[model samples]
Every structure is written in structure tokens, then in C-alpha cells.
Target: MMSLNQVCPYCDITKINKDIVSVDHLLPKASFPVLSIFPDNLIVVCKACNEVIKGETIYLPIAHPCYEEVSRHFTFVIKENNNNKFTIEIATNSKNSKLINQKIYNFIKLFKIIDRYEKYMTAELQDYRTAVRTPNKCVFIELGQLTLLPPNLLLKRLFHSKFQPCFSY
Candidate 1:
């Protein structure tokens, strides 16, 4: 039962387009027919995540967004490649809890978070590069302002054009 104003739990994308927001079955109806109508089985997620988690094929234990406070267990690590490209990885910090570790792993793999994030980062870098090269464009990112936002909201701002530009004529 997530609101559109919130980020998608799976991918951490801000739902800017209402058309892409959808009610996804946490456990696909095709596989869990009995739980199809179960209230807990339904979650609000962006269409991209729905497409990625198409159905019952994801049998590995994933953290239930409603029941599990799993965010603290995982962290995103981004590494820069030699060619100025970047790759992303999700590292689990729950060393004491094997089950939590497994759920984090399964969630990352099932959602292809690493791959998708890398793709997004690459595209974002390209956009930034373009913005930087455009003449008379005054762009500045206020890292200090981002500190006030939650992790997901900070990411949403970073990924979008939330960084305001300062101009001096």
C-alpha cells in the first residue's frame, strides 16, 4: 500500500509518471492463485519493476515490503570503470542474519538492481556530460541540500534535474 509520492521499494525510482504506477502482485497470481486476492500480496510499484518481476519465476525469498524493514541490510556501491563508465552492486550488511542476507541477495538478483542501476548511472552521466558541454549553461549541484533528504528521495533528486543552476549575467 505505497503512495505514488513515495519511491518504488524495489528500484527506488520516484514515480513521476502516474501512468506507469501500477498495483503489482508481490506473489504473482499465476503462481499463488489462492493468495491472488490476499491483501498482503498486493503492492504499489512502478511498471518497470512489474515488468522486471513478471511472475512466479522469482521463487527465492524476497523481503516483503510491508512486513520487512530491509533497507538497512543493503547498501549500493558504485565503482568507476577505466573508460569512465560505472557499475553498481548491492552489498548486504546483515552478516549476523543469514536469512536477511539471502533475502537481500535474492531481491537484488530478482530485480536486476545492479544492472538497472548501472544503466541508469551511465545514462545520467551522459546527460550530465551533455549539460556541461552546452554553452552558457550554468549548472551547480548543491551536495549540502541533498543531505536533508532521505536516501531514496536523495537518489530521486540526484537522478533527475533537481540540481538547480545559478546564472550570473
Candidate 2:
């Protein structure tokens, strides 16, 4: 069941190799043992995300996947560096609400999402540059391929402007 997911929703680790995914209790089983039995409380995440990033720490405002579609409130800003690499930053879509913005920030911090992405971006950017530079190669930038990287904006802009006409089917 865990392998069915292409990437970890929290940390965005691609499930390419072994089964490095594990079940994580969103509310923490140590805190709410009764909810441990509830399927809704369980979220399948990467091993690093479950054990290292989140650990036993609890988060308020509950970005529970079952109840709240909290991800829509966040946006990833991708900036191209002069060295042909990219830097990614997460920004909250909700500018007016402090509480909503704080929740978004806490979620990012708790999972160390940016740190993880930064590590992967160097390699992914290199691959991206190579794919784009190669001629007649249809570079399909699927949203699923990107996962938490960018839902829409980043690659779309890159292909249009930087890559100078790449094909996506």
C-alpha cells in the first residue's frame, strides 16, 4: 500500500528504490493512543520524514490531510541562480490571515521541507538542464513528477522562457 505512492507527501522523497515508506500518526500515537487505531490518523510517509524530521514533536492548527486541504494555502517560489541552479522558497498564499500563515510556516519547519528540497534540487536541476539542452527530446514536466517541488508555476515558466520550446504531451 505504501509503495503505491510515488513520493512522500511531507518530505517529497521519491519512492524509487526500496520500501523506505512507513506509517506515521499525524497526531502522534504517544499523545493519543486511542486515535492510533483510527485509519484517518495514519499517514504513510518517508522513513526520514517519520523518524528524523517530525520525530515526536506535535504541531497545532492541525494540517491533518483528512480534514484540511492545507497544501493549497502554500506556494513554492523557484528562483533561478546565475550558476544555472535554482533556489526554492515556500510562501503562504494567505496574506491577510496570520494564523493560517503561521500554520503553513510551522508545517514547513516541522518537516524541514526546504532543507530537504535544497539537497535534492542540485541534482534535479542538473538533470533538468541536461534534458532541456538535448535536442528533439520531449521533456514532459508532469505535476506528479514534480510532487512538492512546484504544483504549476516553476517548470511551466522555465520551459516557456529558458528552455526555448520543449514539448510536453
| Among all candidates shown, the one with the greatest TM-score | 1
**lDDT of each residue in 95-128, candidate 2, tens digit only:** 5288877776777888877776676655666667
The Cα RMSD of model 1 versus the native structure comes to 4.4
lDDT of 1 by residue, 1-169 (tens): 3456866877775463577777778888887899888888888778778864544556468877678765667666655568867666566664638887887777777777777767766666556556666677766753334333443554665665454555544
RMSD per candidate (Å) reads 4.4, 6.1
What is the alpha-carbon lDDT for the whole of candidate 1? 0.66
Name the regions of candidate 1 deviating beyond 4 angstroms: 14-17, 94-96, 125-154, 164-169
Q: Which candidate is the best by lDDT?
A: 1
Each candidate's TM vs. the true structure?
0.72, 0.65
